[model samples]
Target: MPTLLRLHTDRPGHGSGLRLAASGEIDLSNVDDLKSALADAVAEIGSSGEELVVDLAEVEYVDSAAINVLSAYADAIHRIVVHPYLLSTLRVSGVTELVTVDPVQQ
Candidate 1:
């Protein structure tokens, strides 16, 4: 069975910045969840100019669609926290060039 993607949005207090953390696999099957979450996060942080921190540490996998969605929001995103396993994928996909990609600290 495929693991359904889960998204958690939060703001780490005043002037900290907005964040969207995603867990589980992010393939085409559940890419919309990521898109919607990003859109909602962006809308919620409207006019504040706060950077969006995308935490994908728990994400097990991601397809091109998922990368596309992240790329689409590169300007709004401050950094992306991903597992070491996914770092190469992000690098190959050019996501690392578009935005900061950090490996989750063990």
Candidate 2:
């Protein structure tokens, strides 16, 4: 079965930060989309090198491949906002160490 993933990139409302909104499951089927979304978000910010914030609020599941995708953007991702339950997934995947994981009790 194919997982459905949706990615929307836009500038942050507060500042020049890039925001990538990811919805749906993040598995092997859609991990590449996540990566492309982040990359596109960064590119949209030009040469600012400011920051990329991934909003994982609507995300339901994240697999190992998805974690690896996030790991690759560790340097560019400033913060990852996720559901409280997803905190364990990020920590276990070692993504918390690379980037900031802000768990929002949703």
For lDDT, the strongest prediction is 1
Q: Lowest summed-lDDT stretch of 10 residues in model 1?
A: 1-10
lDDT tens digits by residue: candidate 1, 35-97:
999999989888888888999999999999999999999988989999999999999999999
lDDT of 2 by residue, 1-106 (tens): 8899888887656776878898889999878788788778767776786777899988899999989889988888889999888989999889999999998665
For each candidate, the alpha-carbon lDDT, in order, equals: 0.92, 0.86
Q: Can you give the lDDT of residue 50 in candidate 2?
A: 72
- Residue 14 of model 1 has an lDDT of 90
The positional error of residue 98 in candidate 2, measured at the CA in angstroms, is 0.3
| RMSD (Cα, Å) of model 1 | 1.3
TM-score of 2: 0.90
| Model 1 CA deviation exceeding 4 Å by range | 1-3
- CA error at residue 74 for candidate 2, angstroms: 0.5
